[model samples]
Target: MSSIGGFLAAGLIGAYKYRTRGTMSTSVFLMQLRVAAQGTVVGCLTIGLAYSMAKEYLFDKAPKENAKSLTN
Candidate 1:
């Protein structure tokens, strides 16, 4: 969640940078929005992948009782 917030902050800063430089027209804002959206999607995917990998590599061999915790 904090990482997502960081990405959002970076996007806002990027937009503000362009706006202050008089380079961010409406089209530029739209493009920035697209970039932010893509960042969010990528972030979510990365989190999912990391969680899966952590479970597989670090916890998959644990006892069945632990596995039940994972499922619920």
Candidate 2:
């Protein structure tokens, strides 16, 4: 969700910049989209990996009783 938001924001910003410059091209727009897509993929992957690591670490260190409490 956040990655999508970031991508949209980037694209919008890029478009705005191009419009302000009074010169817009398909190539430039496509380039912005490509960059946005790459950023979204990297951001999502990084977030997923970080969340997984943190979850595993927390669960591993949690007491059995405390872990059981989560099921309730």
Candidate 3:
């Protein structure tokens, strides 16, 4: 999913940039795309990590209704 999203993002960036300035060559375009894709993937991982940490933190702060076991 991340890979697909990255590729899509890269493709969009390539099209947009190419149409705007027309200065970037094929190799530069390819590199830009690869960087864009990598950046997207890294961004996703960072977001996921932050989300997990926030959830864990919230859960830790939450109060327990009862500590006793059901059999008790």
Q: Write the per-residue lDDT of candidate 3 for residues 24-69, one digit (tens) a residue.
A: 6878877876787688778989999999998888667877778877
Per-residue CA lDDT of model 1 for 1-72, tens digit only, reads 987787789778876866775655777677877887798789889999999999988978865663355454
Error of 2 at 62 (Å): 4.6
Task: Point out the higher-scoring one by lDDT: 1 or 2.
Answer: 1
Q: What is the C-alpha lDDT of each candidate?
A: 0.78, 0.76, 0.78
Error of 1 at 38 (Å): 0.6
Best TM-score among the predictions, by candidate number: 3
TM for every model, in the order presented, reads 0.50, 0.52, 0.55
In the range 1-72, model 2's lDDT, one tens digit per residue, is 975787688778877776775566778767876887788788879999999998888657755663454455
Provide the lowest-lDDT 10-residue window in model 1.
63-72
Could you give the candidate ranking by TM-score, starting with the highest?
3, 2, 1
